[model samples]
Target: MQLQTIVPIKPLGNPINYKAKIVNIGSCFAVNMAQRLQYYQFQNTINPLGILFHPEAISRLLEFVVNDKVFTQEDVFQHNEIWSCFDAHSDLNQLEQEDIIEQLNSKICRFKANVFDATHIILTFGTAWVYRNKQSNQIVANCHKVPQNQFEKELLAVETCLENLKKIEQNLRQINPNIQIIYTISPVRHIKDGFVENQRSKAHLIAALHEYLEKNKPLNYYFPSYELLMDELRDYRFFGKDLIHPNDLAVDYIWQKFVETCIHSNEIPTMKMVDEVQKGLVHRSFNPYSDAHQQFLDKLAQKIDVLLEQYPFMNFR
Candidate 1:
């Protein structure tokens, strides 16, 4: 008997241009992608409040929105001042009742309300696993030093994830029905989890996300950051010493693939073009550096000069 192999669907053409206001949510990998977009002068927002790694942050955000509060960076810094507030001598209940925390909560609520107007919403799920507080019936972003034994647990179901995503989409659509949603599975490995478990976890997220995207059609799309890293550049050289996160070179490679697959579908631009684009936009001030670093910058400058000669368009002057 002959068996047929199923092939994955590839992205069809250049990314459709829409003057987009983008919001990125989920794991650290989302941060990396957001940085790349910002580098390219794309209007994008990645967690306006900052790194939201746990369930408490999510809940707090909702609470803030509902209450009509304004948040500043100082407020967030104060919230995360401790390593784990739940473990500290301070009273958790009292802290929750504080006026500042309440104010911060209101701000988060407003942010969520504003998100519905975003032109594009991008989410990257890091894991299916989540911590839950049984008594409170709420998701906890972090255990907050609560004893591992006492902290309740729940693994997010594929169905639950899909439902949540649908709700998020629905809410956004109410504000702007034409908004587009993009989902990506973060490629950064979870080193805290054992290697075997990490792989299993990633597989679960990817499978769930893939199925969800397929069922939803054009309203949602999946970007292949995970596949590009795991399949194309699987070598150790692409990873940092930590063995979990991609090194600078790996990130650049994945970014190139992203541009190729999503931004320019037909022809990949030359490295010289990439460099020229970067230099044209870079506004950083040069500082005195050691001989080695200076040498590297000097070589880069020379290459830029040569490329300018070859392609006069690269000369901003």
Candidate 2:
């Protein structure tokens, strides 16, 4: 009867609903959850600066948004003939200096706009280990394939992680005092850092995050994403071929748990309806001109029209 241990999750005080303005940031796992939110047609924005893996990188992003920092030629550099910014993920890189600068500034503007009105902000931290550029004496978000000799690898201390967490909260609250923050530690393991090293990194992040939550209380909520994967779904089957990232099935299971705890009960019907429409949209008709297929298309169109009528923000196209 008790084959597995469940990670008991409590219902959120201010659970997300159709009306909630959501913005997700941090690790690639955050993108997983954001994909689910997007599928359900929720008002969600994700990773404008791209996938930031550590707390300090996230803090730097928030600092840029809060301080209205402008990007210039000096902020970006060329490596392997591709221009990149040390403060952002490679997803934002471009072929020219002006293009990258413009892209970064544009994304920052978008992030600032969304965050100022965001009701719920989700942050997922991937590691405490970071690469500090020896020349700049600063931690970079992404190394961008730079030579390893140019950077110093170091583990961020618990105190520094805690400080970054607090600063993130303070900065967000300053922009939108009513914003509720949800924090989760990424479940993906960085085995390249070495097995023991990865464990130490996660421990530091977990300790610092919990300490910050315990001290600050309700402005922040901790979701045990790490525990759920490592404990509840403790099987190799739940992981991708890399044996690091959670597979699609595991992400679906975790997302279901997230819905049960963090999403509003009233929105379940809408979510189900959205799921149906999504599946119907992708359904293939074996016969191109069959009456049955036409009827199915009609039903799908009706569902889309109804949802769009109720939630104008939703786009089935």
TM-score of every candidate: 0.67, 0.99
- True lDDT of residue 105, candidate 1: 53
In TM-score terms, candidate 1 sits at 0.67
Residue-by-residue lDDT tens digits, candidate 2, 72-143: 988999999999999999999899899999999999998999999999999999999999999899999999
What lDDT is obtained when candidate 2 is compared to the true structure? 0.95
Off by over 4 Å in 2: none
lDDT of 2 at 262: 95
Compose the digit string of candidate 1's lDDT tens values, residues 1-317. 73422224356232633245677776777788888776554556776455444223433443444445554333322333442222111222233335545544543564565576576777776765666666556665556556576566555666666665555555556556776767777778876766776777777677666776677776677777777778777788888898888888978877776665555332234443444557744534365466765776676677667656754443333
For model 1, how many clashes? Answer: 9
